[model samples]
Target: MDGLSGQGPAAADRADTAIRAIGLIKDFGDTRAVDGVSLAVPRGTIYGLLGPNGAGKTTTLRMLLGIIDPSSGSRVVLGHDRPIDAAPQIGYLPEERGLYPAMHCREAIAFMGALRGLSLPEGRRRADALLAEHGLGEWARKPIRTLSKGMAQTVQLLGTIVHQPRLIVLDEPFSGLDAINQARLEEMIRTKAREGATVIFSTHVIAHAERLCERIAIIAKGKVAFEGAVDDARAKLRPIVRLRTRNADGPWRSAIPAGTRTSGRDWEFELPESGPEPLLRALIDGGAGIETLAIERPGLHDAFVAIAGDAAAAAMKQEVPQ
Candidate 1:
């Protein structure tokens, strides 16, 4: 089984969900950061919490990790009611970067593992192995300040998993990474999931979620705007049809859906509930010389815009790094 419906370790072993949250809410002073947000993450799968800046992604993650108490609601992590109870089994990389620049690369990783109850010797052994596996063996003794930004970030990530946690949570981990480093991180995430660890991450970058998430929850303005598999979200919107023909007007015009628009020799519109067959037949029967007809499925970005609305989606896009 994967871990979602069960309560304890035995039950979790019999189920497929690893983490489950119900009606989670967080309040600070007067502002409600998270409003009744609930989600279930399947065991051994990658789940994404997607939203724009200040959209409550981080707050929700924090609440789940037991880093902060929620104003209301409940959560189960690794089959335990208290996330802190399962601390040794969870690996987390917060949005903020905090590694001692004065510490050696291997010592830094070993220290992080040691905090999770790993013995110093064992932590150092694991750190050395991890650094070597990630192609940084030569720099294991060098200070963190001496490494490049990407290298430092890589070392920090290695530290996160040094103890081999069953669940990994990363918040905006891609921030400030170049394309190469981002790709490397994506590979690491996949590797963790493939090894039977449940992974949950929060990001404003829809592209990352779209590419890596098996299940995603789109949080907008402190609420869940949409949640499900990527394909299911896209299915909520109609497919688009693009037509290019010699005749843009006349009886052929009738074939275009009522809400569709036409410009010169090009036409574009959503496929109606009746399906594209009717429209195709209408165009052909009207004697319009068909030059090109293409149907395109809605992508995740399009689905995000549809569910989260233009304003929120635009804001998210703006917040994404260039």
Candidate 2:
């Protein structure tokens, strides 16, 4: 049942959405940071919130956590109507991670759990389990200041989830970790999703979105530029299959033979909606001496660049009004 509760037959529909925001708006004096943004995060999925810095990602997350009041609009986390009401059921790891560096790893993790409404002994028990799970048991007694960035990150992660919250909001959780730790973090995120906890994280790393999230929202210039299944977002950009040959000098470069265009390295482009067979046949008949062939499907990064770029261009045009 995903450990989430709601009421009535509508409960089923509501349970699917662990977090929902409608007409969410936050203003800082004259500047509108979040402008009428509506979002839904399905239960037990790792949803990625991606955007460039100052695109209102932080502001929006703060609103979700009830850290700051919205100028307008409303949000619901789990079944809670307000952020403070949801605090005990929600775990958050902020972008700017800070801890009592002087405190030992175990104590630090336990302390955070206590703040989340866990008892002292219960917090210590959860901390031990988490540290052991993260392969940091050996350093559990060491002061946080003595641990490396990766080690400390593992502790921070443990602290955030120790109370077994139903929803977690992590901001740049992988920012300082190395490749090994990043992989570990990814694994942990997956395990959380499997345990029926809805996980929403904000990250600049597109690879994380590609690897972990079932769906992603790319927020740009204070708005959601793209949101949906990863494959769907990629499909939005269309598909292009590229053919490369040792010989760049070929007739294929000129006259693309309809529905196709030459890119580089004897490459050809085609939209998936049209299928690939026609494009493949054209390249074969071109007699371009194909040494290698590859299909270039749109990726998350491509979609992000496309949407973010368009938003920036639009903003610029508005600024240049006569």
Residue 66 miss distance in model 2 (angstroms): 1.2
lDDT string for model 1 (83-158, tens) is: 9998999999999988999999999999999989999999999999988887779988999999888888898999
For 16-111, candidate 2 gives per-residue lDDT tens digits of 688888888888889989888788899889999877667788888999999998999988888677878889988899988888999998899899
The residue pairs that clash in candidate 1, if any, are 2-15, 2-16, 3-16, 3-17, 4-17
Which ten-residue region of model 2 has the weakest summed lDDT?
313-322
Q: How accurate locally, in lDDT, is each candidate?
A: 0.90, 0.80
TM of each candidate vs. truth: 0.92, 0.86
Off by over 4 Å in 1: 1-14
Supply candidate 2's per-residue lDDT for 256: 44
Q: Say what the RMSD of model 2 is.
A: 5.5
Q: Please give the distance, in angstroms, between residue 261's alpha carbon in candidate 2 and its true position after superposition.
A: 7.3
Q: State the weakest 10-residue window (summed lDDT) of model 1.
A: 1-10
> Which one is best on TM-score?
1
